[model samples]
Target: MTSFRQSDRLRNVRYDVRGPILTEAMRLEAEGHDVLRLNLGNMHPFGLEARPEIVDAVAAGLAPAQAYSDSRGIPEAREAVAEHYRRCGIDDVSADDVFLGNGVSELITLTLQALVNPGDEILVPAPDYPTWTGAVNLTGGVPVHYLADEANGWNPSIEDIESKVTPRTRALVMINPNNPTGAVYSEETVRGIADIARRHDLILLSDEIYEELVFGDARHHHAARTAGDDVLCLTFGGLSKAYRVCGYRAGWVVATGPLHRAADLLEGVTLLSNMRVCPNVSGQYAIPVALGAGAPGSPLPADIVDPDGSLERRLALTADALNAIPGVTCVPPRGALYCFPRIDREMFGVADDEAFVLDLLHTEHILVTHGTGFNWPEPDHFRIVCLPDEHVLTRAVASIGDYLARRRR
Candidate 1:
C-alpha cells in the first residue's frame, strides 16, 4: 500500500484564526463553555441584519435564478457593478468588463490563477488579508511582503513597494480600508501606489470590499480610478462586508484602463469565469438592488439605517473598548469591522504575539489572530473583529487588559 500525502501548496496555508483555535473554540462552545469569539469577521451573530429590500429582491428573482445565468454573471448584476464603480470615479468600465463570482474570495483565486505564472512575484502588504498571500501561493506565484507603515496610519509605503518590485513582479495587491488594520488609504497613498504600478508596468489589484464602511471623515480612495491609463487595474468588491451579506457570496471584479494591454489576461480570466458557470444566481439577482439601495443619492430603505446600524455601533464600541486597554494601542479604525492593535511586549512581558494570543484565548476565553497570520514579521500585534456587541467587546477588551496586567506582574 502506498502512503498518501498532501500537496506542497498546503504547506504555508495554516489559517491561525479559524484553523486550530476556532476548532477548539467551537468545541468549547458546544460543550457550553463561555467563549467570546473575537476571531473571525463574521457579523450575522452580532445582530447585523441584511437589508429587507435585498431580501425582497432575492425572493423576487428566485424563478429566474432557478435557471442558469450568464457565465460572467447576470446582465443586471454586472451593469449594477459597473455603475457602482462609475460612481467611484472609475471611468469607461462597462458591464462586459465585470466578472462576478461566489465572493471576493473566489474572484481573487480566479484572478491569480489567470494572471500569475509559476515563480512570478506579486507585491502584497504585510499585515494584509491572509487570503491574498494564500491565493498567490496556491497559484504558484511568490507573494512579496511590502510594508504598510504602522507609523503612517498603516498606509502602504510607496518607497517600500518600489524596493520590493523585481523583474518578475507581475502585480501589486492593495486592500483599501485594509482588513485587520482597518486603515483607509488616502488619495495621496493611492496615487503613489498607482504611480509605482505604472512605472513598473505591474497589474494593480485593489480590494475595496469595505468601501462603504468608512468611519467619520475617512475616505476610501479607489486605486483603479487613480491609476487611469498608466496601469492595468482590477478593483474587487462585494456585498459581504458593507451590506452584511457575506452568506450571499456575491462579488465582482472590474477591469479598468487599457483593455488591449491586458487582453490576454482578461481572456484567461473570462475562461476561468466561464469554467465556474456563473456565481450564485440568487446572489446575482440581489446585486443590482444592493448596489442601487446602497448607492449615494438613491433612496435607501429606512430600516437599512434604522437603530443606528449595527456596524456603526460596533465600530464605536470596539474603538472605545480597545482604547481603554493598557499596552494595547489601536488606531481608530477608519473603516472595516476590525482593529489591529499593537501590543507593547515590554509592558506585557509577552515573548511574541502568537504566544500572547494563545495565552489570551486560554486564560480569557477570547480568540484573536496574531499579526503573523497577516504575514507581519514581528509578533507584537493581533487583530480582533469588532463584530461582537458593545458589552461583549467591552468585556473582551477588559479581559485582555486583565491578562496583560497579570503578565506584567
Candidate 2:
C-alpha cells in the first residue's frame, strides 16, 4: 500500500501560527485544562467585535449575496476600496484597479501564484506575518529575508534590503504596523523600500491590513503612493484587523503605478480569482459601508472596549509588563496588536524556541508563538497578542515572568 501525501508544492510551506503548538494546546484543552491563548490576534475571542452598523450592512445584503458576485468583487465594494485609497492620497485609483478576495491572506497567495515561477526570489521581512513566507514557498519561490532592525524599533534595515536584491528578485513585501513585531514603518523607511523596488524594477507588494490600527503618533504610509507612478505596486488591505471582522474574510488588493506595464500579471490574478468564483458575498456588502463616505469615524468597537483606549491600554500594559521581567525586554509596539519580546537565551537556558514555548504551554498553561515560527532567524523571542483585557493581559504576562524566573533558577 502506498501512503497518501500532500502535494510537492506544499513541501516547504508552514503556517506555524496554527501549527504544532496549537495542536498541543488543543490536546491540553481536551484534558480539561484551562489555557490562556495569547498567540493569535483574533479579536472576537477576546471580546472585540465588529461595529454594529457593519454587522447590520452584512445582514441586509444576505439575500442579494446568495448568488456569486463578479470574480474581481462586487462593484460597490471594489469602488469603495478604490475611493478609500484615493482619500489616503493615492489619487489615481479607480474601481478597475481593485481585486477583492477572502481576506489579505487569500490575496497574498493569489498574488504570489500569479507572480512567482520556480526559483524566483521575493524579499520578505524577517519576523513577517508567516503567511507571506509560506505562500511564497507554496509558489516555489525563494523568500529572501531582510532584517527589521530591532535596535531601531524593528524598522526594516534599508541597507540589508539593498544588499539582498538580485536579478531573480521579483517583488518586495512591506507590512506596516507589522504583525508579530507590531512596528509601523516610518515614512522614510517605507519610501526607502519603495526606492529600492524602483531601482531594481521589482513589483511592490504592500500589506496594509493593519493600516488603521496604529497607536500613538504612528501613521501608516501607503507604499503605492510612495511607489508612485513608476513602480508597479499591489497594495493589500482588509477589514480583518481594524474592523474586527476577521471571520468575514473581506479584503482588497489595489494595483497602482504603471499598470499598463503589468497587464499580463494582473490577467493571471484575474484568472486565479475566477477559479475561486468569488469571495464571501455577504462580507462584500460590509466593504461599501465600512469605507464609504458615511463610514464611522473609527470602525473599532469603542463602546464595548472603553471608548477607543482599550487596545492602546492593553498593548501598553503588555509591553510594560514584559519589559519589567528580569531577562526580557520588549520594544514597545507602536501599532498593531502584539508584542514581540526578546528573552535572554543564556539566562533562560533556551536553546530551541519551539521547545521553550512548549515548556511554557505545559508549565504556565499559556500559549504564545515562538519568534522562529515567524521566520526570525533567532530562537530568543516570542510573540503574544495584546487583545485580552487589562486584567487578563497583566495576569498572563505575570505568569510568563514567573515561568522565566523558574527557568533561571
lDDT of each: 0.85, 0.91
Error of 2 at 403 (Å): 0.4
- Quick one: RMSD of model 1? 2.2
**Clash totals, every prediction:** 0, 0
State the local distance difference test value for candidate 1. Answer: 0.85
Task: Write one digit per residue (lDDT tens) for candidate 1, span 206-308.
Answer: 9998888887778778888888876889999998877778888999999988888889999999899889888899988778888883456765322343247
Judge candidate 2 at residue 212 and give its lDDT.
Answer: 81
| Number of the predicted model whose lDDT against the real structure is largest | 2
Shift in Å, residue 401, candidate 1: 0.8
Per-candidate TM vs. native?
Answer: 0.95, 0.97
lDDT for each residue of candidate 2 in 1-409, tens digit (9 for 90 to 100): 9999899989778888898999999999999999999888888998898768789999999999999999999999998898888888999899999999999999999999999999999999999999999999999999999989899999999999999999999999989979888899889999999999999999999998888888788878989887789999999998888788899999999999998999999999999999999999999999887775445565432233234688988999999999999999999998889999999999999999999999999999999999999999999999999998899889999999999999999
lDDT computed for candidate 2: 0.91
